[model samples]
Target: MMKIMLVDDDRTMQAILKTLLEMDKHQVVLWDGTSESDIFAQIVQEMPDLILLDYYLRDRNGIEIVKQLRQEPQTSHIRVIMTSGQYLRDECLEAGADAFLLKPYMPDELLRLLHQVQQNG
Candidate 1:
């Protein structure tokens, strides 16, 4: 099973994602990385298999977080899947995200991306 972290400010989205991922047998960690230190600590310590980062946080963007993750050797290699309500694939990928998912996507779509990441990487 994959260990996935969902970084989103929306509690509803977090709950839905947790349910979906858990139903698929993957572990989920719901955190927005609100405090810079929290995300850094969690990523380095927990080292989840994947990070489902929202494109826009209340205070920051996922690309910034992803960039930070890439800087740390311990977290650099972890696959990060960025989700966005808008089309920001280029920007997210440029910042080192492994994959991009548009918002309002189906659970099957998310699973398909996860499977692709696992197979390719």
Candidate 2:
């Protein structure tokens, strides 16, 4: 099991993600039913193995968070998956996401990506 963070602003998405990850025995950290706040500092302290971030968050864009994580030496290596309804694969990749997932993605797709990341890393 891996320690993963689900950083989407949508409560439904967060619940779904948490349930699915927990089903597979992966430990999941959430936004605690609130918008991601001071997320950069929180992430640095928590240091999960991976993060699944929404492209357009309630408080800030996921790319900005990704960039900050990459810029900081301590959190730079954590894998991030950026998901959005809009097309942002290239931009998110450029921002340092390990993978970009379009919204409404299937559970298997997300699971496959996680497996791949763990395998490669």
Candidate 3:
């Protein structure tokens, strides 16, 4: 089972993802979007196998977060799957995400990507 981190500002999204991931036998870690300053540190500490990051966060965009993560040795190697309501797959891939899922995606799509990433890793 993979340890996954869900970083999004929406509590409802977090709850839904947590339940889905748990049901899939993955451990879920929620990032409370309270402070962007501490986000990197929290993620580094958590060191999850994969991060499911939303494209638009309240404090900052996921692109910036993914860029920062790619720059840091502590987080550079972790798998990241970026999600968005808009179509930004190219941008997300350029920012270092392993994959991008447009919001309202099917659970099977997410699971397939998760499995694919896990296998590739």
Candidate 4:
């Protein structure tokens, strides 16, 4: 099974995604709130197979986070999927997200994306 890390400030989103991903048999680690520094550090320790991040983080911008992640040799190869209710599709892609998923996505779509990431990884 693939290990996924969910980084979002909204508790509801984190919960919903966690449930959906878990149902698909993926191991999920969830992080909520605005502590990017701590959260990134934790991610380094956990080293999940994939990362699903919100476009707007409470502490730092999602683009910045992605850049930082890509800069680190250890975490650079991790697949990152960015989701947002506000950003445009191209914006997410341009920001270095491997995949851009809109908010309130269907479970099936999420599953497909996860599977694709797993397969590609």
TM-score of each: 0.93, 0.94, 0.97, 0.91
RMSD of each: 1.4, 1.3, 0.7, 1.5
lDDT of 2 by residue, 12-108 (tens): 8899999999998999998663436678767876789999889998768998899999998999999999999999899999999999999788999
What are the per-residue Cα lDDT tens digits for candidate 1 across 10-94? 8899999899999999988877546845776877777899989998887778888999999988889899999998999999999
Better of 1 and 3 by TM-score: 3
Give me the overall lDDT of model 4.
0.84
Q: Could you arrange the candidates by lDDT from highest to lowest? A: 3, 2, 1, 4
**What's the TM for model 1?**
0.93
Off by over 4 Å in 1: 32-37
Model 1, residue pairs in steric clash:
none
User: Which is the winner by TM-score between candidate 1 and candidate 2?
Assistant: 2
Worst 10 residues of 3 by lDDT: 32-41
lDDT by residue for model 4 (1-121), tens: 8899999988988898899889888899987465777878888988999999888887676788888888899989989998888756787777677888887788888888878877877
lDDT of 3: 0.94
Best by TM-score: 3
* Candidate 4 weakest lDDT stretch, 10 residues: 31-40
Instruction: Give all candidates' CA lDDT scores.
Output: 0.88, 0.88, 0.94, 0.84
Per model, state how many residue pairs clash: 0, 0, 0, 0
Candidate 3: tens digits of C-alpha lDDT, residues 37-57: 777888998999999999998
